[model samples]
Structures are given as structure tokens and as C-alpha cells.
Target: MLHYAYGAVKKSMEAYVTRTGSNLLEVPLPFAVKSNDEIVSEFRKALERGKSNGNRVRLNVIDHVTSMPCVVIPVKELIQICREEWVDHVFVDAAHSIGCTDVDMKEIGADFYTSNLHKWFFYPPSIAS
Candidate 1:
């Protein structure tokens, strides 16, 4: 799967010591962004297709099955809203939501998410028990 890291995360790491260079970089917002177009038009049209509705969209679904993994709302919703507004970048801090749930990195549809293997998944020795 493809991966994109947030600018803050890209900058968080301490500078390197050896001759090796860092691969992390702030992903630039697409030079050419599209909005108020067919996607938005279709989205608004789809939304309008329903009447008298109280709807909520959750982005982090465990296979779109019979459960919600956590008590809080899915952060991916934020990405959707921002994307609709033509905003750039979404940083996902996955500290509390890693291995405990399926963080389907690609499916979440966010610009970036920072996950530590320790907090949720109980991996990575650097994470506290």
C-alpha cells in the first residue's frame, strides 16, 4: 500500500548522524487542486438525494461490519470535511488506535497518520506497557 506522512511528522525526527539521508518529507499539496467540480457536484447531489435525514459518516470501520472499534468518532471524517472544503493535509495521530483496531492505512483515506506500535498494538519496545 502507498504511504504519506504529515509535515510535522516528517520534521519531528532528529537530524541524522551518519552519511545516510532522511527519506521523510512533508508531502506537498497537489500543485493543481480540483474542487467545485464533478466530484463535488456528485457528492452534493448524492447528499441531496436523501430527504429528512440525520446521517453520520464513520471512516474507521472494522470491515464495515457490526461494530465500532472505539467510542470516539472516526478521525477520517475530518479528512472528508477538509477535503470537501478544499483544504490541504490531514494529520492522523494513531497513538490510541493502532493494533487495537484495524488501521487500514490505505482505506482510511487520510493524507497522513502517525502510529506508534506500542500504544495500541503492544508492539515496539519504545512504547510503554
Candidate 2:
């Protein structure tokens, strides 16, 4: 199984960019990040662009603080922000969270998770059951 999942979580972000031509990234630096902070900014920007905070998104998404690759974010804090912001989508990009970190879909409490096994879970190449 993929660690974080496929960039499924980003699917929501894509929607925002498609709907609104705005860029609000928490870590828009050398590389694009998938942190919880980034997720927050994306939603915040969407809301600022005439999007409904209560019903702006039909889904619920959140970013995570990963310690697997020197990445970290307070999941609880993000959740709190979600509740406070009233986001409609909650997707988490956990590509580096498969074997490197123990992730329980239920424990994470995210509406969606984007993880890849090949990245950290030692998944076999093109091996299928």
C-alpha cells in the first residue's frame, strides 16, 4: 500500500487553483511542500477569494506534520484550525509516511491521505497480487 497515498489530497488543491487564480502557500520555497501549514494557507486563500468557509469545499482535508523526513506539523493544531476555519475538504499528503512512519488511517483522522509505499515502505516494483 502507498504510504501517504497518491497525490489524492492535492486533488482538492487543484480544484482551488482551478476555481480561483490565487497562490497562498505557507512554504512556497525551493520545493513545493505538502505540509499542514501549506494546506491551511490554500484554504485560507480560497476563502479570501469569495469562497464560502462553511460550504466552500464539499470535502474535508488537512496537512500533517511528518517526522519521517525532517518534516513536522502539529496534526492536532491543523485539525483545530480546520474546525475553526470550517473547511469542506480534508486531504493529507503523506507520501513519506508509509514505512518510515506508522500511519493509521483512522488515527490520522483525515478525510483523505496521499501516500506512496515505494518511497518509504519498500514496495516491490510493479509487483501485484
Candidate 3:
């Protein structure tokens, strides 16, 4: 079921790219232990470069990566960065966050979000059933 969901996401992204002719920038996992400030700084640099190149950032998709147990990005900071960078849309995949943390999507200011309730909430397998 996870595989199918991931495939669907990939196909949707592919279709979006095809329709908009926009480039996708996949964020790589950090190799070393880093502070949130450091990570955000690096991300900001990338966004700045894109902005300078006359690129309109249509979407900024961020995976919470809760499974990795890595740094959870502060949504406020992320939203601020996106706004400053002129991003038109933001999507966050909170698959591992639904039951583990408080996710106020409206407060986070993301245009779209999705999560798997079964993974953390022990909900019935609606998609796979």
C-alpha cells in the first residue's frame, strides 16, 4: 500500500512537471549531524539561487521524514522562507506525523498535505482493505 501511494505521488509529480515544465529539486538527506539553522541556511541558499535565475517556484514539497528521526523542520520557518522566496504552493507529506505530533495545516500555511493514519494511529486499512 505504501508502494502504491508512493507510485501515485511520483506519477502526480511527473504530470505536474510535464504540464508546467518545471524542474524538481529533490532534497538529499543530510550526511552528518547538523543544526536546524544550518539546514535551513543551506536550503535558503538553494532557493535564493533558483529565485535569481528567473525561476518561479510553483511548489515546495517537504517530507517530514519522521521515520528518519531527523530534525523536524519548524513549519513557521519553512512557511516564512517559502513566502520570502515567492513560492506559489507548498505541500508537506506528513505520513509519519499524524498521530505523533500536532499538525495544524492551516497554521503551517501549506497548500496541500497528506498522511497515512494507519501507520501511526492504528486505523483500519482503508486504502488497502
Runs with alpha carbons beyond 4 Å of true place in candidate 2? 1-16, 19-69, 124-129
Worst 10 residues of 2 by lDDT: 23-32
What TM-score does prediction 3 earn?
Answer: 0.74
Tens digit per residue, CA lDDT, model 2, 1-129: 112223444565567767886432332211245665664564455444434343343444343534333454445455455556665556666655566556667766666776655665467754311
Q: Write the per-residue lDDT of candidate 1 for residues 33-101, one digit (tens) a residue.
A: 243243334433433332125432222111111122223224454457546644445556665565556
Q: Which residue pairs in model 1 clash with each other?
A: none
Clashes of 3: 0
What 10-residue stretch in candidate 1 is worst by lDDT? 58-67
Q: What is residue 76's positional error in candidate 2, in angstroms?
A: 3.2
- When sorted by TM-score, best at the front, the candidate numbers are 3, 2, 1
lDDT against true structure, model 3: 0.65
What's the lDDT for all of these models?
A: 0.39, 0.49, 0.65
Candidate 1's C-alpha lDDT?
Answer: 0.39
Residue 80 of model 2: what lDDT? 51
Q: Per-residue alpha-carbon lDDT of model 3 for 12-100, expressed as tens digits? A: 88788889887766544365537667657666776775676687778776655434444465556766788887889887777766766
**Candidate 2 lDDT (Cα, whole model)?**
0.49
Instruction: Give per-model TM-scores.
Output: 0.39, 0.49, 0.74
